[model samples]
Target chain A: MTTTLRTRQRFAKAGVLTGLVIGGLFAALPVLWMLSTSLKSNGEVFQNPPQLITESFSFDAYAEILGNGAQLRFFLNSYIVAFAVTVLTLLVAILAGYAFSRFTFPGQKTINAVIVSVQAVPPITLVIPYFGLVVALGLYNTYPGLILTHMVFTLPYAIIMITAYLNTLPKELDESVKVDGGTSWTALWRILVPISVPGLIAVGVYTFMISWNEYLFALTLTRTDDMRTVPIGIQLLMGQHSYEWNQMMAMSILGSIPVLVLFLLFQRRFIGGLTAGAVKA
Target chain B: MTSTTAPDTTAPTQEPVTPDRPRTTLTRRLSPFGYLSPTIVLIVVLMVIPIVMVISYSFRDNVIVQENSVFAGLANYTTVLTDPNFLAALKNTAIFITVSTVAHLILGLAFAMMLNTQLLGGVTKAIFRIVYILPWLFTIAVIAVIWRLLLDPSGVVNYVLQTLGLLQEGVNWLSDPGKALWAVTFVNIWSGYPFFMISLLAGLQGIPNDLYEAAAVDGANPVQRFLNVTLPQLRPVIISMAVLDLIWTSQQFALIWMLTGGGPLNVTEVLSTFTYKQAFSEYEFATASAAAVIVLLLTMVLAFFYVRLQKER
Candidate 1:
């Protein structure tokens, strides 16, 4: 019986290992393919029985993409918009999260409810109205327009995450600051913000990713090549006559690097933030 | 001695300073608003106001080019509801959501279970987790493009399949009307399942081993232990994740737009893409807004349940 049990356990372990390996490959295959395709020349991309790894590896696609000033502009635009959105979101979210976590005030429940409901509203629903609004305000094709629109999604997310993080902290810290005759501002800026650096960083990274990956608003709001973000730029690469598959793949890989780096650097905190935001909320 | 006695005498005087407490209480009552004002103002301008405007636009006969709004009451809604394209989009969205959500949940649970078994070393497991979530981290545009290349008629998928003798010739996955919707649904599942995986893994980790041990002592097998112990523990997480996934997958636009553009005769025309086409492609703002309002109402109902779920937890 002991031997049988050991055999069954070993079989189960092997099954699990097999499943993990398969799942990992399934997850990584498309990305690996993208890398492979990006390194291939155009002719190789279209070759019969497409090569997983081309014999003649070339950086021509990357070079072509980097050589294009418009592509670089898209990258710059994305960086600016993402950075601005992250800062704006973090500032608003920290203040609002601190309030929600610490204070019991009039209309608090209503505001909280509004925030929650707003998050549930699908962003595409507002695209038309926002288009009209932005055009009317003459903010179309502008960075501020995209930044403000991106905040509609990011602010609520950041606020909720920061609030959840703050909820885990003791209230005594604020009270102690109060006892020290320090104002609420001092408590937040001095006591809470310093301690909540990890949470703040998580929210910042989340906001940056959202803005960087945003497409619909970027597509609708920005008209000029200079204002278009990376995603839009990539879409434009697929013109009617010629689909620059290699260069598009190169740009896609380039666009993903910031997010990948952020995830790799803050893997634990980022995952914790995501799981905490989802599971708890 | 005098100093101690003086403070003792002063303590009685300090007790009468309760009059200031009400004023402080008044500030306390208003301060949350002060902190929340920025968020409130931004949401009002960006989200709340736009939502209200969209709803109003749905009631008017508005065109993007014309910029003239004449109240048409429910005419726009009627038009959208009766349109064949709109009906098709609604049906397609339902099918997509049902299939994608189920696929993600099942596959995600399987992946989570495998990961939870600890069959691999710590480093290997960590690498697997990262690999699984890489798709989720990738931008939808990038994901769409990568998948487009893979699913193209002459793409690697067909090449590999043909090499393995699974197909006699390359199949047009994206351009074929019959397969386009399912193709995009597959992509959605690929990128989306990791969300469920991570959440379920977290849920699984939270389950105590003692429960499983107790079930084993009760002569329960592995499947029985899972059904009896794990399912009940994971119920809340599953429900919440499923609900959120429903909203998200329903609103998905970029992937479909990039991969197929609701193409091959609008086989994958979801409500989001439908609305986009009406507004931008056709310049029919009122009709598009009406469709969007319908989508909003559907998601709002789910959101109501989601809120209740959160409160229950």
Candidate 2:
């Protein structure tokens, strides 16, 4: 009876472990394949029973995009736009968030409701209007134009997230700062700003990911190859006559590297930010 | 209206918190506005204005029959419903939503259960979480392209099957009308389940293991234990994710657009992508907007029920 109990316990542990490891590795298969294909030579990309490791790994695909294609320009455009939007959104959301958390005023409830309701509105509804606005403002194909449009989605997200975080802070902190010689602006900048670094970092990374991954606005608004973002630029590699799978995969892997790195560096905060939706009433 | 006198000529006012003087009226009303000014300005210029424009454009004839602006109340909407493409796209979108949501629920629960096991060490567990999460981080366009390569007639799946003598001929997975919808769905499930897995896993972690042990001692087998113990506990997380997944899948476009573009006789044209093509490609803005408005209404209704059910829980 004792031996049977011990064996059952051992089997249960082993069974569970095997299931997890196998399941996890299978889930990882596509991404692993992507990385592998990104390294393979053009000739080897579609080879039957795709090789896990190529005989001669080549940088030719990477070189093709970097050396010839306007991929670098696209990367730069994406970087500039993502950073600009992130900085602007953080500054604005932090202020709005602070006010929403700390203040009581007429229309406060209405404003909060509006912000939450706006999350349901489809972005496709606004594409045409944004297109017209960009054309009219003479900002078509410009980085600022794209950045401004990207904020349509990111700004509300920032406001909601930052406000939620700020709610956890004590009201006494604000009163205490007021009790000091500091003004509201002084307290906000000197005290509140310094303390909200983690929240800000989380919101900043979230906003950056949205901007970086945005495709429709980037694809439609920017016509020139030089003005393309990474998604649009990588997509253009698939041409009218023939698709360049190797180079396309290479560029995609490059495009994905920054986001992957960002997620790795801030996994906990990033996941927390995503799960923020789960908590809303 | 000359009721109150303006406070005596700029006397250096003592601190209000000193309990000596009354608060200034301007400071009270304008302070919140000062904090919210930037957000309001941005919302008006970017969101509100654009939404208004879409509404107006939807009522115009400039999209379908004419290039210049002309008022055609409900004309675009009328034309959209009559169009063959919109109807087909709508069907495809519905199927995608139904298929993907169910797939995510099942796959996610399985993943969460597997990860909830105790034998895995902290490091190996973390690695597994990251691995599962990597696909969800990718743009839909990239996922579409990568899967396009993999699902081609001579792509990886067929190659493996053929090598193992499992099939006589390679299947044209993407080109066939019958298979294209599932093809897109298969990729969506691959890219989607991670988010669900993470959320469900988080919920699973909070469940005490003693319940499972107690059930086991009661002579419950693994299947019975799961049904008796796991399902009841995971109900809230499952329901919430289901609602979110429903809304999200309804709006998903990039993957379908890139993969099939509502093609092979419009087998997979979901709502969002369909609206995009109709408004932009077909230049039938009115009908497209009407279709979008329908989708919006449906989603909002679903969301209302979801919220109510959640509150009840």
TM-score of each: 0.95, 0.91
Candidate 1 interface CA RMSD, Å: 6.8
Which number leads on lDDT? 1
RMSD of 2: 4.3
lDDT tens readout by residue for model 2, A1-281 = 99998899899878877877677766777777777887888788788667988986887888887886467987888899999999999998888897788667799988877776566666666676787788889988999899999988888888988888878776656656656654555556677778888888988988898899888889778888899998887677766327777788888888887788888888998787667656453
TM-score of chain A of each: 0.97, 0.94
List, for all models, the DockQ compared with the true complex. 0.56, 0.50
Candidate 2 local Cα displacement, residue B54, angstroms: 1.6
Candidate 2 achieves a global lDDT of 0.78
How high is the lDDT of residue A62 in model 1? 98
Candidate with top TM-score is 1
Q: Which ten residues in a row have the lowest lDDT in candidate 1 chain A?
A: A174-183
